[model samples]
Target chain A: MSRVVVDVVLKPEISDPQGQAVLGALGRLGHDSVRSVRQGKHFVLEVEGTPDEAELKQIAETLLANPVIEDVELHLPKD
Target chain B: MRIGVITFPGSLDDVDAARAVRLAGGEPVALWHADHDLKDVDAVVLPGGFSYGDYLRAGAIAARSPLMADVVAAAGDGMPVLGICNGFQVLCEAGLLPGALTRNSHLHFRNRDQVLVVERADTAWTQDYRPGQRIVIPVKNGEGRYVAADADLDRLEGEGRVVFRYAGGNPNGSSRDIAGVTSENGRVVGLMPHPEHAIEDLTGPSTDGLGFFTSVLKAVVAA
Candidate 1:
């Protein structure tokens, strides 16, 4: 079995309203050092065999993330 | 021909959607999320609510539910499907519709009677009204903002796929003032308003929402 870690995040062009709200809350809480905050989803997957990088990318593109507004990153399991 | 309404665990409007179907002179069939069987229904309605408690994303969890596979296939065969509110979220997450519903721009759950202009009367759901007809219906949601890529938005607008546009004022800051949209083939539609809630004047602000139900009947007969 192989393990795969995928992270889906909104594209730079799309507005991150939730992250902006959190940034505002941080300033209100007196944490002024924080410059920016971008939020995204992290998912872990276990597959029976060692899937190729192309397969992983296809899965992430087709199902894990919406390419129109989001980008995806795949972390393959170490040997 | 019967309209099937699938009830997810946390669905809040399945009953009302079925009632609206009955009122529109169509038999209503109750379906379940876990069940893959579609029960030979002629059409399907994914009613609104916080399905799967809106975990992962508003409709992300429910979009992958067992029944949705069947729903997607049936929709591919030209079966009409309408999604309202959270149901609209599910359709987007499932890739049956474009765009995503994000948190309201003003950061509050809005609930009120909203006016919408029908942009296209060609969809199976909006054929009862003429193009540019105005109607009032209730829209309630916090994550109802619709967003898409600039190119996709241009395509949607250019191809006349937009079904409804918010009128008077943009309530939730949806891009291009889009309140609803139809699929490429016009067999599927998703909207952020509660048409079923506005079908009866005794309980709702207006009966303008009945056009959606009646429009489907007309389409079904014409088909």
Candidate 2:
């Protein structure tokens, strides 16, 4: 069995309002050292058999992320 | 003219959209998300709502529904399609339109009457209005901020594809105050306002939105 992890985040050019809100709260709570906070989605997938990078990339690009506003990164489990 | 109002599982404004069509003298055909049929409608309206509970993303899942396949094709063949609010997000996700609707910069679910200036009246959906007409419509959504690459925005502005712009003030911080835009051929339009809810004087901010429904009939006749 293999587990694939995907992280999806908004593009840098796109405004992250939620992240900004969190940053505001962090400052109020006295976490001044923290510079920024960008929110994103993380998904872990379990497959019966090991999947190739291309297949997982297609899944990440197609369903897990929107190319227009979001970027995606994949993390495959080590053997 | 027959106008199709699609109802995804979580759609909340299908009935209102259909009523707008009926009030505008067009037959409102109910279309389902899972069904592949378009019911031979002359035009289509993707109404406002939190389809799929906005799970993965607003309108993302619904954009990939079986019926959307047909919508993409018909829209390509010059069938007029209007996407409102969440519907606009779906159109962007489905690649029928450019850009994406993200959470409002204020991170609030904004609901209010908004004044918009009609920039283009020659499209399949805006023919009933004169250019630069100011109309009042209800704008409501959490994810209504429109974001696009700088180059795309410039091109759209150059081509006059921007159909509507906020007049008084920007509600959701959309790029250049753009409330709505059109496809290259001017057939498909997507906007982050509730035109369907603004069709009746008693129930809406104004009857200004009736033009969108009425315009499609003329568009069909002209076709």
Candidate 3:
């Protein structure tokens, strides 16, 4: 079985309070090396066969991510 | 007047929505997420709760549910529809409304009494209140911050479609302090606050929320 993964994150223009809170917590924990953090969602889909990039994009855009406030990226093996 | 209250799995406020409809002298019809039948109701209410267990994102799954297809079509026909809290998210995700509700800008779930100014009273849900009227209702939510493209927001503002604006401190950092909005035709209304929960003074911070239900009933009577 092949797995296709999609990562959804708030667009740069959108404010991410959850991510900002994590950054604050990291600072409190003294993780000075980390400059910033942006929170996002990750979805791993196990399909019967490796789907082409076009089909994957449709899935991510239609169901996995909201285009209004989020950006989506697909992780797939190069053909 | 019959108002259909859709109960998606994990919905916490459908009962309250029904109660509000009944209190407003309208029949409350129960609608299920999986059912295509709208039960011939004159209006529809997408009540609040973590539909689909809020999987993936709040209201995302429920927006794509089977019954939403019917709701969308009916809404297009100018049937009055109201969405509360998670219901608001569902309406946005379903393309029935513009903008999205994200995590509260403060990164916390806030629940409290909130004051709102009725900016537009022409909508199917707000006809009972006068413009600039101030009302108190209970607001409870986590991802209630509203965000939209600048141009879309400007249009919503320029057209005077904003139904409710925060009068007190902005509770969830919603852009432009918007607490609720109405469709271009004013047939659909969506808001982050729980009007259904504030119908009775005995249980809620105030009975101001009852105006929304009463307004819809009035709309039906006039129609």
Candidate 4:
């Protein structure tokens, strides 16, 4: 089995409204334990066949995310 | 002149952007996200879409692409770079520009034709239009709001970096109704509107967006 991991982040200095809203909601929910909240997503896939690391990186870069506002890192399981 | 359009993962508008470039009398070069070579294009355009599925943040992931390193270097060398929507996010994420795009204040994915006033006509992307001219373009995105500190906003305004401001209603709750902006040198521009989708009148919102493409061509030729 082949596994691919995708990591993402917002561009630095760009405000994250989603994170702010979540933080507000946390305060209301009495989870004030949360000091800061930043929202982001991740994707992990298992493919049938082996694909080169470059190709997987390309896939993650082109169709998997928007480069303008999102940052991504791709990791493959070690052989 | 050849214009390179970078295609990042989740990029939805590279094809349209390339077509617009071609329609505006420039050869469109397709640049892959993994490739470091810019193929010797005169200018570069980072198109819109949900790169990395808007994961970590809009344009944040894609900004680190190997290809972007070249873009940043070239842009610093004064090669014109235009980032539309997601592309704009990438520009900001890549540190090629300032400010960040946040989610719409309404928290809804907005897609509509927007009217914007030309705030700056001296940039490579807006040179075709006169200052204060109003134009319509399509804007579709969930994270389209713009935000910056008070001092940064003041600096931008003082330096005349504001490039486009919403003319009618603010569609995405952008700060000061800002729709676009330019770098200090005026060679790099980033806007939330989709100019590529506005190039063709038959199928798109308005033809006003065509001027952006044509403007870049003129600037390149004159330079």
Give the winner by TM-score.
2
TM-score of decoy 2 = 0.98
Clashing pairs in 3: none
Per-candidate TM vs. native? 0.92, 0.98, 0.97, 0.78
Candidate 4 chain A, which ten residues in sequence have the lowest lDDT sum? A62-71
- In terms of DockQ, which candidate is strongest? 3
Candidate with maximal lDDT: 2
| Candidate 3: tens digits of C-alpha lDDT, residues B1-223 | 9999999998999999999999988999999999999999999999998898888889999999999999999999899999999999999999998899988998789999999999998899998899999999989998999999888899999998789998879999999999999888999999999888788878998889999999999887777
Off by over 4 Å in 1: A1-3, A30-33, A44-59
Q: What's the lDDT for residue A27 in model 2?
A: 99
Fraction of native Cα contacts reproduced by each candidate: 0.25, 0.75, 0.95, 0.20
Candidate 2: segments with Cα more than 4 A from true spot: none
* Candidate 4 positional error at B28, Å: 0.6
Q: What's the ranking of the predictions by DockQ, best on top?
A: 3, 2, 1, 4
Q: How would you encode candidate 1's per-residue C-alpha lDDT over B1-223 as one tens digit per residue?
A: 6889999989999999999998888899999999999998888899999998887678888888999999999999899999999999999998899998887888889999999999999889998889989999999999898999888999999988899999988888899999999999998999999999988879999988888888887777777
Give the runs in model 4 whose Cα sits over 4 Å from its true position.
A1-79
> Candidate 4, residues B78-185: lDDT per residue as tens digits?
999999999999998888888878889878999989898999999999989999998888989888898776678899999999999998799888888989889999
Q: Write the per-residue lDDT of candidate 3 for residues A31-66, one digit (tens) a residue.
A: 988988999999988877767779989999988999
lDDT of 4 at B48: 95
lDDT scores for all predictions? 0.90, 0.94, 0.92, 0.88
Q: Count the backbone clashes (under 3 Å) in each candidate.
A: 0, 0, 0, 32
- Compared with the true structure, model 4 gives a TM-score of 0.78
